[model samples]
Target: MANATRSGNYPPLKNTEHDHAIGPLRTVELHPERRRNTRRFGICGRIAAYLMSIALAAALLPTPIGSETAHANGACRTDDHGIRLTADATGESPHFTSIQFLSASTGRAAGNGFMLGTSDAGCRWQPIYRGKLTFAQMDFVTNSLGYVLAGTSPEGPAMLLRTANGGSSYSPVPNGGNRFARIDFRTATEGFGFTFNDSGAHYTANGGAKWSKLPTPPNTRGLRFFTLEDGWAVTLAPGGYLVKRTTDGGRTWTTRLKASSAVGVGGAVYGAGGRDVWVLLYGGSGMSQTSYSLFHTKDGGASWKQVVSNATAGGGPAPGPAVKAGKLPGPAGRPADMATPDSRAAYLLAGSGAMDKLSLGRTMNGGKTWRNGAAAPGFEGKLTFPAAKSGWLAVTSLTSPAVYATRDGGATWSKTFAIPAD
Candidate 1:
């Protein structure tokens, strides 16, 4: 038999079982025994044998089993059953980057290349969207109205896509905004958009139907808005990070607290409601061995106190291919997150060693006191606490990405859903 060598004439094929089987058949004409047999059979017989071999090889080619319906133009179309992925989805485990809960029983999730919706909290999920676009952030003003930031590839110019029927379908918002790294909507008509490395922001007063440029301070890392004119943001300062408040909207900012540290890199802000809020500071110089500080304020940034002085954040960014074979993948993009249920209760998840090696911390008395909560298994992705005692967590793994619920704060947890690749 002739040795088979792939050429550059066609797209590279994966080394799947079908490839191994079809490879030799395609190159059979080069074999010494087959060449002699072809000469003895004459041209007509040779043609007959060649036709049979072609039929045999065609039968071995794998057929796609995806449930996605085809459009008239041959593009895959999405339906109630989202785009189904093949067995080999990607090189690593599926990683869910963000989760948005509209109510106690309904929510949506965005991951590497897909989005999911759950009507029974995190107990069950339905694939709502799938494609090659990378989801950066998502915001839902109601059960049936939402927005998402996505781009064609990882190096993104994350534009806006609006959904009206609870993400069943989406359409691009005309001149809505572009390259917005994060978006927060305080009401159906009041929303804000911020960029990671720029000075100008965008705001909408009519539920994203139109957008207007809102000048902002440079180097803003995190933001949480309470109203169109009132909000809090974390900005890069000379020493470390500055927690600033903008009562006149983004036009002006007042430093509420200065988190000065030798290793302070950036920070994120989270709000419970009314006057309760938490600020998580990321402190580290490298991707490994991250350290964090948690601050709390009961009077809406009027006064701030450090509740947790120092805690170890195990990882920085998502690990590279050097990670051990079976180890869980790490979280990417945003490093830490906080869920505030009330004026005196909040749960914070931050990187422990890897980006998703998360540790849970709970504070029941606003920010006056905090305690460690039971850590759920797998890499923690996002947290949503609807009440002081009822909360849901999204956890990611290699084979199955799941959702876990906690009824008594974060003291205990139970698996609710293990999302299968569909």
Candidate 2:
């Protein structure tokens, strides 16, 4: 459990080496862009997971100008990450994917069908439930109580919703035909649901209505569970991609690490417990040489290292003081979005890089050391911090829907509304 420690990558100094008048490179890197279920890896793997979720949601869309989004006139200075995060409230269909926050006041944002919320730290936002369901999974352990999982299609009637006052209203847990691609609940009724491509991950003690089948390890994408027995999952095999753990709820499992320098893996996997886990692995040499890094695990997730890196697979982990792969822009400088509330304060987002701007990185004392934060625009999704100053950043592209807030942990951010229309 101690055989990883390599680090190298600090590159970022092109485009005429800055000074194009003074500022224009906010840790640029954007373009780099999940899970599981039941026991039916059948019907041709559910028609190849419904054509791989329409090419994996178009390969997880969002590559507009620099990747999450870009477009600013400019104003707020002091290292203007691009002066983003705006809204009196407007949306034709800007779009949002998923966002969750049970504290730092409260939170919710779901994609497509629209769901909205906030409670103070975010200034003031309302509207709780609106329908047709386009959510991909929303969670809450407090702030009223919550759980959502609508937006389904892969041959079956899927829907799982429940709200105890927060979302204002919701009721649908007849999740019997379970088409779960992702779901989690350590309480609020003790729950868990998963799928990497077709139905086969379950364990529900009532809150989710009903479910059973559990034992899974093959290709499971991001099955979470922080307590009620502990949990974690991530696998791809065939030459590297594993990461597993289970304390009892999932029956039995262990593996904890094996990225093999990864080529892809993104959706959701971050932690502040169980030895403090975190995951973000992506690599590319085609489509214009992309890159990404940031892996860590204390002892519960077996073994891992590479606290952060850029391209060329960068040396092996834990070496520090490195950067260069276009000199940190994002979209390839990869740090799409991340937030850790413990193990020593954390938050990272470099979305819309390549020049559109938006870079915010902070680490109180965890990832060695980092600073430069405060920027906004969109593209970053789900970055929550329930305390330690309080945080929340959930944005979607096409014009950057909205939902941002930070009391101090993330330097600064505001918005906290807009995202309802279409």
Candidate of highest lDDT = 1
TM-score, per-candidate, Cα-based: 0.67, 0.29
Candidate 2 residue-wise lDDT, 1-422, digit = tens: 22443222212222323111001112211111111321245566556544543442232222333222222442221221222222212323436667876665546666655556544334434344444456666876665666777643323344677765555445667555756776768678877777554225677887765677777666675566666467677666664456677888678878766665444343246776577777655544332233555566666654455455546433222112244443432222335667777876767675543333456666665555455544676535657676766777776655545667777777778775654433
Q: How many clashes (backbone N, Cα, C below 3 Å) per candidate? A: 9, 39
Sliding window of 10 residues with minimal summed lDDT for model 1:
17-26
lDDT of 1 by residue, 158-262 (tens): 876666555544566644545677777766667777666433468887756778876556677767666667777777777677778787867888777776655
The regions of model 1 sitting more than 4 angstroms off are 1-93, 175-177, 197-200, 272-275, 285-287, 311-335, 352-357, 419-422
CA shift of 201, model 2, Å = 6.6
Candidate 2: stretches off by over 4 Å = 1-126, 129-168, 174-210, 216-254, 257-303, 306-369, 372-411, 415-422
Model 2 lDDT at residue 114: 51
Clashing pairs in 1: 84-422, 105-121, 313-352, 314-352, 314-353, 314-354, 315-353, 315-354, 344-366
Cα displacement (Å) at residue 124, model 1: 3.7
